[model samples]
Target: MNLLDKFDAVTVEADFRITPEDKAFCEAHQAAYDAAIQSFHELAFFWEDMENTQKELLGSKEDTYLSSRDGPEISQRRINAHLEWLHRAVISNIVYHFNSTYHVSVRDDYVANNLLPQMPDLRIYENKEAREAYHKKLREAKIRYEDVFDQMLLLLDGRSFTEQAFHELAEKCHKAAWNLYQNKANYERKKALISFNGYFCSLHHYSWQDEWTLEDKTQDILRGVAHYETGSFDVYPLGFSELLGYQRSPNNEHEFSTCKKVKGLKMFKNGRVDIRFTSETYAAEFATRYLGLVC
Candidate 1:
């Protein structure tokens, strides 16, 4: 049968079973979950100690954090300071994971920045009546600053040290003690999958198997399911090759032509899968392909 025809023969339905190996691999990445939780805690800690005092203006109620609204340079200073503290801790976290996967640990920092900027200083203010509007702007500034951090935590909540990072490092470290090994794609997929929460299945799992699976320390198996499976779904477990618009000839079965990984795939620490698409069109096509969606 033709390759596409074979894909046609396979259809995705409810209650799919992911393989044990994949399941175990997912479970083995508990460090990632711990990293997420620790990262969240660290973020909250920083917000309470750092932003509340400096940005939030917590000492006096009427004199809230924005009472002395500094321009862009001041705000950026605060952000850089906050991120500096964040960098120190996350660096250690990444090192801890790499240490566990290998016999030795490195004291070096692998600074990973997940937070983005929200520039609130650019809002226009016109006159004395603008003083009334100024409060609103300040409030917006507080929210905007907090939002960048809040979402940054959310991003951290979705990530850990289990992706192509290892794929690349594994090859370099193969000759080193406590050797590392995984295919380039598999390593990349693992990292990408960690970015996901229970909201979506790992592309790592979806790419190689029908589902994401996990095993407990006792060897009990669990199949990862979508967090929100009730509503109509837009994408299905089609071969990533087709889903991502990757093109390659069959003769080079292992050959894939692109480095673009569809962003925002989801997963959970307990080892479950979820599906959320960045756009409806991609979702629709995925559903049509592997989900047996009628034309």
Candidate 2:
């Protein structure tokens, strides 16, 4: 039989696998696929721009506020590269942000100022000279950032000393931080899921296959899926296991049937899930029903 006929011979199971090249191809293509939907790599530049702008604005506040997320900058050729990097970035981000920004990156633990006068538990051992030199460098950074923040706040209408302004900005920071924490969790939760693997198995393009390990964020809904559906409906994702027909709570019934019929599953590296509705109601229903029936 010709190569096309070989498609029928393949079966979907653990026994089936692609070569490393095929895996790489799938990863590459899936990255491209993700990029087409979500501008993840663009975030690298976006974050860089943000960092630069913030730094320039808060030149002295660097030490007072840890504004940097520790990762080398990245640039992507297209959406594909962005998508590929997104998977790595989100997981890294979930870890980084929790330790760097919020205490709740992990369960139970949270970040907050403590009563101790001791510095953070960061330890470095080397020659006394090296330790001294490192401390000096860090001190300089703190001074510069503190001064920068002073200048920036002063520039923000000279309200740096005002209690109301402090309260407002503090509230904003807390809210933004909370939102960031939840978003990371949502990503982590979805990332733990396994669904697209079903599609991945079905769409095995071993000859042209690209291995993809995806952690999707729903900011970009899949095209041709119910995420963008219009007309009447509201959608809420109950859970990932729900897709395979697993129900963990009675709350699942309240999940609006708006665009699920053909909904695209968004996965994240951390463990959180939310929903995006579609523009078309019937198509959405069709997608949700079809997947339910098929699954």
Which candidate comes out best when scored by TM-score? 1
Scored by lDDT, model 2 comes in at: 0.31
Compared with the true structure, all predictions reach lDDT values of 0.31, 0.31
- What is the Cα root-mean-square deviation between model 2 and the actual structure? 25.2
Error of 1 at 225 (Å): 34
> Candidate 1: lDDT over CA atoms?
0.31
> For residues 47-151, what per-residue lDDT tens digits would candidate 2 score against the true structure?
657657767877845642323376444332332344433333433333343223311122211111111122333454356666655443332221111222233
Task: Name the runs in model 1 displaced over 4 angstroms.
Answer: 1-15, 53-295
What TM-score, to 2 decimals, does candidate 1 have?
A: 0.19
lDDT of 2 at 35: 50
Model 1 residue 45 lDDT score: 62
